[model samples]
Target: MGLLIGVGVLVLIALYFIGIYNSLVRARNEARNGWSQIDVQLKRRHDLIPNLVETVKGYAAHEKETLEAVIQARSAAVGAKTPGEAGKAEGMLGMALGNLFALSERYPDLKANENFLSLQEELSATENRIGFARQAYNDAATIYNNKREVFPANLISGGFEKAELFEIEIAAEREVPKVEF
Candidate 1:
């Protein structure tokens, strides 16, 4: 009877470890899927940029510096391999794109152009999607990180590394300032 009781307790401990391990695996995969969604949105945003730049180029020939900055930022963003690198590059691209748009305000005809308007709308929509994807990715990473750090799960997570959250390095770039007259 003593031996049987000891064996039963051992089995329960093994099962508990197995359950925790499985949960860790699932959480890690969820985080990867979340990052993949963000990557897809970023790719869409990158693809739309060239068309948008070209449309603006036709009207703002003298604004070569702004256009080149946008192109360079786009290249950096497209080349980023990791989430952190991508976040930084994307932030730079966003700033460059903002400057381009500000320059466009000077060109009345460019603002009125149908192609430009359509491309601008599409880019705006893609930016929104990217924002949502980033949030989801961060949420997934947080869940995985918490699980890895928790008591029982932490003991079982010896083999699994903590997932990194997608973070924006430039906090100032993330905010818009209000202008009061």
Candidate 2:
């Protein structure tokens, strides 16, 4: 009877550890999926940028400095390999885009152009999607970080990768951009 009871206890302990390992795996996968969602939205944003720059270029050829800044910012954003790098690059891109829009306010005809208007609307919608995706990624990272740091889970979490939250690193980027047409 004593030997049978010891074997049963060992089985239960093994099952408990397995459960913890599985939970850790699930949380890590969720965090990864969340980051993937953000990447998809960012890709859409990247694809739209050149079209926007070209449309603006037709009207504001003399605004070479502003246009080039936008292009360069977009390139940096596309090349960013980590969440921290991406946040900084994207913040710069957002500021550059805001500058481009504010510059448009100076030209009455460009603001009214149908193609420009369509692009602006599409960009605005994509921005909203990006915002949501960023939020989701942050939430998932928080959850995974919590799971890994908790008492019992910490013992086996040594194999798990840490997730970094995507943050807007610029104070200026936090402000509501003026969207006047």
Candidate 3:
């Protein structure tokens, strides 16, 4: 009878560990899926850039420097493979895009162009999606990290590494702009 009881207890312990292992795997997969969502939104934003730039180019032919900067920034952003690299490249792209838009302000015709307006709206929507995806990814990563660090799971999490948060390294991006009525 004692032999049977010992075997039963061992089986329960093995089951408990297996449960924890499975939960960790799910959390890791969720974090990865969150990142892929961000990537998709980023791709949409990238696709809109050339059209926006081309529309601006027709109106502001002399603004070659700003146009080239936007193109270069877009290339860097597209080439980024990891979250860390993407964050840095995206910051540059954002600044380049800001410059391009400011250049458009100088040319009333560019600002009024229907294609430019449409592309700008689409890019803005994509940026919003990217922001939401980043939030979701960071939340998932935090949850996974917590699961891996907690006592019971940490014992089982020997194989699991902490997931990286998609962090913005740019000080400007982190700062909130003031709005006054």
lDDT of each: 0.81, 0.84, 0.79
List residue ranges in candidate 3 displaced over 4 A: 81-85, 169-181
Candidate RMSDs in order:
3.2, 2.5, 3.2
Q: Candidate 1 vs candidate 3: which has greater TM-score?
A: 3
| Native-to-model Cα distance after best TM-score fit, residue 112 in candidate 3, in Å | 2.4
Q: What would the per-residue lDDT of candidate 1 be over residues 22-76, giving only the tens digit for each residue?
A: 9999999999999899779879989998999899989998899999999999999
Instruction: Point to the candidate with the largest lDDT.
Output: 2
- The list of candidate 2 runs beyond 4 A from truth reads 81-84, 167-177
The residue pairs found clashing in candidate 2 are none
TM-score of 3: 0.86
- The Cα error of candidate 3 at residue 78, in Å, is 2.2
Q: For model 2, how does the per-residue alpha-carbon lDDT over 1-181 read when each residue is reduced to its tens digit?
A: 9999999999998899899899889989999999889789878988998999999989989999999999999999999998678878888888888888888889889999988888888777777777788788889899999999998889889999888876644443432234643
Candidate 1's C-alpha runs over 4 A off are 81-87, 167-181
Question: Hey, what RMSD does candidate 3 come out at?
Answer: 3.2
Worst 10 residues of 3 by lDDT: 172-181
